[model samples]
Target: MTTRILIAGGGYVGLYTALRLQRRLRRGEAEVTVVNPENYMVYRPLLPEVASGTLEPRHAVVPLRAVLRGSRFIAGRLTGIDTERKVASVAPTAGPWLELDYDELVIGLGATSKLAPVPGLAETGIGFNSLAEAAHLRDHVLRQLEIASATTDTELRKRALTFVFVGGGYTGVEAIAELQDMAIDVLAGYPELDAGEMRWVLVEAMDRILTTVSRELADRAMTELTGRGIDIRLGTQLESVEEGELRLSDGSKFFADTLVWVAGTRPQTVVGELGLPVDGRGRLVVDQAMRVEGHPGIWAAGDCAGVPDPETGRVSPPTAQHAVRQAEQLGDNLVATLRGEWPRPFRYRSRGEFVTLGKNKAVGEAFGREFDGALAWTLRRGYYATQIPTWNRTIRVLGDWLVGMPFGHDVVNFGSREEPRGAFEEAAGRSRVG
Candidate 1:
């Protein structure tokens, strides 16, 4: 009987794991099947550029079907796992949930935004986690600019121009920086609005931002962002975001139509519902070999897995750097297990960290070498351009970067794309009655 291997989640872990397996597994060794909601795996690191319209959304994602040619791709989510019977229940977008039996299982179901009890946040706030959100944010920002420019109401303009972002991590910082830069570049077109009228705020509960990198690098990032009139409130918390008004624990309150929450992420609820062993942070508990504890023939990796760092003797941080390394190692370990050989432990020391502060500006520390300004910015782009999977994506991303060099961000708002049928429906007098 052919061994059936099931992989869940098509983020970094799922894609890399399946890619490695396809390369090593022979024609008859095992049948690999992957289940994910989307047909493409987004290179999430470049999402900031997508939000700023610097990179096309299509180019930033690797097509799963094109890359994982050898594996059976299921455009669905793993709704449940019947581990006792080695069966996985997959809920596709249209069809009823079906169960597939597998000899081995690899759960890499990644994470989702972990929101707190801040009122109105659920309704008003958006996250920076997916391509949809990134694209929507780009259009949303441009729409806000339009509202601020054409409106004469001072209060409405102030609210439209105010942009508040919670979290000072790399994701939040890069997102706000890129979008802010886009806003600044487009401001020249608005004759009535001064750049000073726009407020960009970064709120962090910690004493510093970008704590994953060196303190010096974090301080440098703070300096650069503050210089651009970004309000970086250190050691502050978001008290509430009620009725388009944001209140901070520091006793500050403001009205802003845009609120981006990039605080952090927790493992998908399905990870916990699978009856697998998970850590305190709701991540799958994996041994050094990337195998889930007490679960034979099962493995987990990426942001959803609590992979141990051999160097630090602690769980590795949930970063793309770690996810890529862990997925590679996990794939190797699975192959070794299939071949009746000893599996290897995942061991990787990060080369360094990089944070982009808009175009041509960044702060990074890699290989014990610190870089700032254009040098760091160039290095950041070069590194990601090279590392992004598939030459097709790499070339396209570089092309976008090169083409955007001499020009400012495109201010055209494609918000209408969200409701493409709206115009036709209205013209036909078929608008839905409330």
Candidate 2:
């Protein structure tokens, strides 16, 4: 009898864990199955570039079928798990629920934006967590440019041109910076619009941003952003966004059509629904070795699991670096457990942290050495290009970078992509009415 290993969530940890299992498990030793909501894993760091049109959206994702060779890939979500029966209930896109049996389970469902009860944020504001949003943002920004350039109404133009971003962490900062760069670059084509007239505001409730890295590096990022004329409100909060009017806690108000919320993320709600023992933060309670406490055959890691950092003696932060390291270690430990060998605890200190401040600009500390400008940017891109997985994807990303060097941004707005079936539906309606 072969052991069936069920891996949930095909994000960084899920995919990488399955990849490792497929490589390590001997033929007939075990069967590996991965469940995810999507068929591709979005390389989140490159989302800013995607929004800026620096890299095509398609290239920023790795198709699971193309990469996770020999593993069973189920395009769906893990709705629940029955530990007693050793089965997981998955809901597919358009079908009946599936109960997959397994000898062991791995959970890595990742997280989603943790939105607060700000007045109109839930309905009006958008998040920067997915590839779809990045693509939509690209089109949306260009559409705003078109609207501002064509309309003679000052208020409408102001509203269209003004872009507000909440949160000043890596996601928020990189997104605003890249979009701002794209907007400025494309302004040349919109002859009537002056870049200075466009308002770009960053709102953060905290006194500082990018708290993951050193204070010095964060200061450097602030300098780069503030130097570009972006309005950076240090101790600010979004009070409301009712009817396109944005009110902040600092007793200021503004009207902007675009509001991006990249504040932070919480584990996917399914983690709690799974009936597993999770921490107060709703992350699965796992041992230092990445195994779920009191469950010998079950394991979890990544953002969904509260795995402790061996060095800091604190739960590891939910980051790509930690996820990758944890998954790799989990894979080895899973194999070891299968063979009745001692499992090793996951341990790895972060090498460094980097923040991309748009094209040819970045701030980072690598190996205790701080860097800035083009060198930092190049290093950041180089590092990500290598880590994106598969030679084909790496080459395509590098090619995009090399080709983009000599050119300004591609300003063609494909907002029409958002409504692909509009024409077809109209045609069908006309035919019926005829």
Candidate 3:
């Protein structure tokens, strides 16, 4: 009988695991199935570029069907899992829930934004986690500039020009830097809005930013950002947000039309509902082999799994590098189990880390060697371009970069794309009335 392997979530773990299985499995040895809500997987690292108009939104995502030709693709969300019956429930876009049976199940459901209980935050703040959010941010930022330029009220202009980002990690730092760079680049186009008028603030509860990198590199990034007139408030917290007015922990209040919440992320809510062993952080408790504890044939990896780091003996940080390695290991172990061979533990050493700080500017460490400025930027770009999967997407991403270098930032706001049918709807309504 052929082994049925169902992989849930089409993020880094799901895609890589399926790819590994496709390559290793003998013909008819196992049937691989991948189910995800979206048909495409967003290459999250390029989201900052997407937000800054450096890369097209479509290029940052990989079509699941196009790449996973060898595996069965199901466009749906995993509703639940029945471990005893070896079945999983899925809810498609518009249909009854479908149940799937599998010999082995892989949980790679990934994570969602962890929003704080700040007043009005849920209503006002925007997250930079998804492709839609990133693209919307680009259009929103440009719209804000237009609003600032056209507004006669000084208060409205201040609110429109003021942008606040909460979080000092890779997401917050990179996002603010890229958007700020874009705003500055396009400032010349708006004669009414001066560069000095726009205010960019980065709020972090910690004393320093980029906690993942060395203090030296973090300091260097801080210097670079501060030099660009971005206000970095360390040991500060966002107390509340009400009616576009933000009150900080340090007793300061300001109005900002744009508030990006990149504070942190937690495992998806559905992961908790699966009735699996999860850590205090709500991540699935999985062994180094990426197998769920006490659940044979049930595996988990990536942001949804609390995978023990071999080196640190702690739960591995949810990074793309670690997720890819874990997925590969999970795939091999599954294959080994099927072949009646011993499996190996997942192990990975830190090769390097890169943090992009706008166009032609970055900070990173590779092989114990620290780098900053343009060299770090180039290294970061090259690494992501190669890692995004598929030759087609790789070419498109690089082409965007190459084409953008000469043309500079594109200021055209396609916000109307979101409401593409609005005009048609109005026309139809007018005709009906007539």
Point to the candidate with the largest lDDT: 3
* Shift of residue 364 alpha carbon in model 2, Å: 1.1
List the RMSD of every prediction in angstroms.
1.6, 1.1, 1.0
Tens-digit per-residue lDDT, 20-118, candidate 2: 888898898899999998999999999999999999899999999989888999999999988999989999877899999999899999999999899
Model 1: colliding residue pairs: none
lDDT scores in order:
0.92, 0.92, 0.94
* 1-434 per-residue lDDT for model 1 (tens digits): 88898999999999999999998988899999999999999999999999999999999999999999999999999988887999999999787888989988999988999999999999999899999999999999999999999999999999999999999998999999999999999988888899999999999999999878778989999999999999999999998988888999999998999999999999999999989888899999989998899999999999898899888888998889989988898888888889899999999988888899888988898888999999999999999999988999899999999999899989999999999998898877854553
Model 2: lowest-lDDT 10 consecutive positions: 209-218
Each prediction's total of clashing residue pairs, residues at least 3 apart in sequence or on different chains, is 0, 0, 0
Which candidate's TM-score is highest? 3
| Model 3: per-residue Cα lDDT over 311-353, one tens digit each | 8998887788999899999999999999999878999987899
| Model 2 stretches with alpha carbons more than 4 Å out | 430-434
Q: TM-score for each prediction? A: 0.98, 0.98, 0.98
Ranking by lDDT: 3, 1, 2
